[model samples]
Target: MTAAEVDAYLAGLPQDQRDALEDLRKRLKSRLPDHIECLSYAMPGFRQPGPKGKMVVGYAAFARHLGLYPHSGSVIPLIDCAPFKTSKSGVLFTPAHPLPDALLDAILRLRQDEIAAGYGRRG
Candidate 1:
């Protein structure tokens, strides 16, 4: 889905879920004003174009929780995601208690570095 489609997707969600996800999207856009917003793995995310163009990260909201997808193999595992269910695949952030800014910053920075260094390529 394109960025517009992504917006539509969020709009279709419940009020609370839409607000939470849209907040995340706005913050991400402010941090990555130059990057392109795209649907990576069917989720809303940012990407840098070129030969090395790749999705740095993405997010999805489910019936139970919100998920951050770093698109890497090791970054998620390296972080301590206490009180939240986490694994190599992604980190779950519930609406009742969303992820902290520090953890989200760390995740984005790590994924950006991996993309810049050509370390992790999404499948």
Candidate 2:
């Protein structure tokens, strides 16, 4: 899916959720210059380059909070996600309390390394 799909997803959310996810979308775009922006698993996400490219990250808005999905179960556990609610595959935050840049950077680095090493992908 294209960015327009992502845009539409964001547009349908409440104002707070929209702003929060939009902020994340911008951050992801800035960091992942070589990655393709698309909608995956019905979430706005970035994919690695090429036909075989994997999903690097994804974000979505929920009724109570926003979620940042690394698309890998192991990625979230490897980082310090204090002060935010987290699950095995996603980090949950609110518009008032967004994920920090450093945390996002760490998540990106770890996920990139995992992708490079083929950790979560099947051959």
Q: Taking the tens digit of each residue's C-alpha lDDT, what string does model 2 give over 3-49?
A: 88988999999998898888889999999988999999999999999
RMSD of each: 2.3, 0.9
lDDT of 1 by residue, 20-44 (tens): 8898898888878888888878789
* TM-score, predicted candidate 2 vs. hidden true structure: 0.96
**Every candidate's lDDT:** 0.83, 0.92
Record all residue pairs in model 1 with backbone atoms less than 3 Å apart, i.e. clashing.
none
For every model shown, what is its TM-score relative to the native structure?
A: 0.89, 0.96
The prediction achieving the highest lDDT against the true structure is: 2
lDDT computed for candidate 1: 0.83
Clashing pairs in 2: none
Q: How many clashes show up per model? A: 0, 0
User: Which 10 successive residues of model 1 have the least lDDT summed?
Assistant: 114-123
